[model samples]
Target: MHELSICQSIVDSILEELSALDPKPKRLISARIVVGEFRQIVPDFMKEAYKAVTKGTDVEGSELEVKTAPIQGKCGDCGWAGDLPMGDFKCQSCGSSGLKLDGGMSLYLDNLEIEK
Candidate 1:
């Protein structure tokens, strides 16, 4: 699955960050990632992929905490700004279909806890 590749990228990034530390961390404790609702990521699959990819690595028993952000949008016609339910992009205030998605398409690492 693509989750494996994603996890590999995460590990690579973590290692790169760790290398930059004055005194490299002894081990990785956890990583917090913010994933937007619009991203089609399966948490279970991600966790499984992480476990597999991190085997025998410094981050081997580390935890991955995923935080999700809801889809937010603004209606171009009505100027309504709010969260949009899945598959329902129409504006709730004026029933306008012209919406501009402003959020919920991000995926990035937010925080990391490590042992020094």
Candidate 2:
């Protein structure tokens, strides 16, 4: 699954950051990531992927915390902008279906909890 590759990338970044530190951490407790709803990433699958990818590494025992970002959009018809309910693309204020989605497509590592 693509989750495996995604986790691999995150782990790579973590290792790179850890190696750059003057005193590398003894252990990684957690990795917090934000995933937009539009990405359709399943949290369980991502966690499983992280566990598999980190096996036998310095981050093996770390937990992956996933935060879901809501889909946001702007209505072209009425110039309304706000968070849109998942799967509902209509503008809440104007009842128009011409909502231009501008958010919920991001995926990034947000924080890392490490024991020095």
TM-score (all chains, Cα) for each model: 0.90, 0.90
- The CA lDDT at 103 in model 1 is 66
Task: Compose the digit string of candidate 1's lDDT tens values, residues 45-67.
Answer: 88888888889987889998888
TM-score of 2: 0.90
Error of 1 at 53 (Å): 0.5
- Tens digit of per-residue lDDT, candidate 2, span 1-116: 78888889999988888788878778889989999999989999999999899999878889999999989989889899999888878999989998888769989988988898
Q: Which segments of model 1 are wrong by more than 4 Å? A: none
* lDDT: worst 10-residue window of model 1: 1-10
Which residue pairs show collisions in model 1?
none
